[model samples]
Target: MACLSKSSTFSKTFGLRNLLNLTHLLKIIHRMFYK
Candidate 1:
């Protein structure tokens, strides 16, 4: 049970990291187009 929770937590953190990376990429793209 403990291992399960740890895996779940790790998955959530990884998902957030991916989302942040995606957001950063989008911002870069938007700046390039606007500029």
Candidate 2:
């Protein structure tokens, strides 16, 4: 039970990090296109 909770928490954090990285990538693409 404890391990399951820990893995869930880790997955959530990893997902958030991926989202943030994707957002940053999109922003860079937008800027390149605008320029």
Candidate 3:
């Protein structure tokens, strides 16, 4: 954490958020498909 630059850390966390959102979206799609 301390080793990273602010912008780099921000982008990293932002990417993680995107990944989480993608997973959540996939779950929703799966539910829709099953239904």
Candidate 4:
């Protein structure tokens, strides 16, 4: 049970980090196209 909870937390953080990176990538692409 403890291990499952830990894995879930890890996955959640990993997902959030990926989302942040994706947004950052999108912003860079937008700037490249606009500028």
Tens-digit lDDT string for candidate 4 (1-35): 99999999999999999999999999999999999
State the TM-score for model 4. Answer: 0.96
TM-score (all chains, Cα) for each model:
0.87, 0.94, 0.84, 0.96
Worst 10 residues of 3 by lDDT: 1-10
In candidate 4, how many clashes are counted?
A: 0
- Per-residue lDDT of 8 in model 1: 100
Q: Write the per-residue lDDT of candidate 3 for residues 1-35, one digit (tens) a residue.
A: 56568889899999999999999999999999999
lDDT of 3 at 34: 100
Which pairs of residues collide in model 2?
A: none
1-35, model 2: which lDDT tens digit per residue?
99999999999999999999999999999999999
Any idea what lDDT model 3 has?
Answer: 0.94
Root-mean-square deviation of every model: 0.6, 0.4, 3.2, 0.3
Model 4 lDDT, residue 22, Cα: 100
In terms of TM-score, which candidate is stronger, 2 or 3? Answer: 2
Best model per TM-score: 4
Which whole-number lDDT from 0 to 100 does residue 3 have in model 3? 55
| TM-score of candidate 2 versus the correct structure, residues matched by position | 0.94
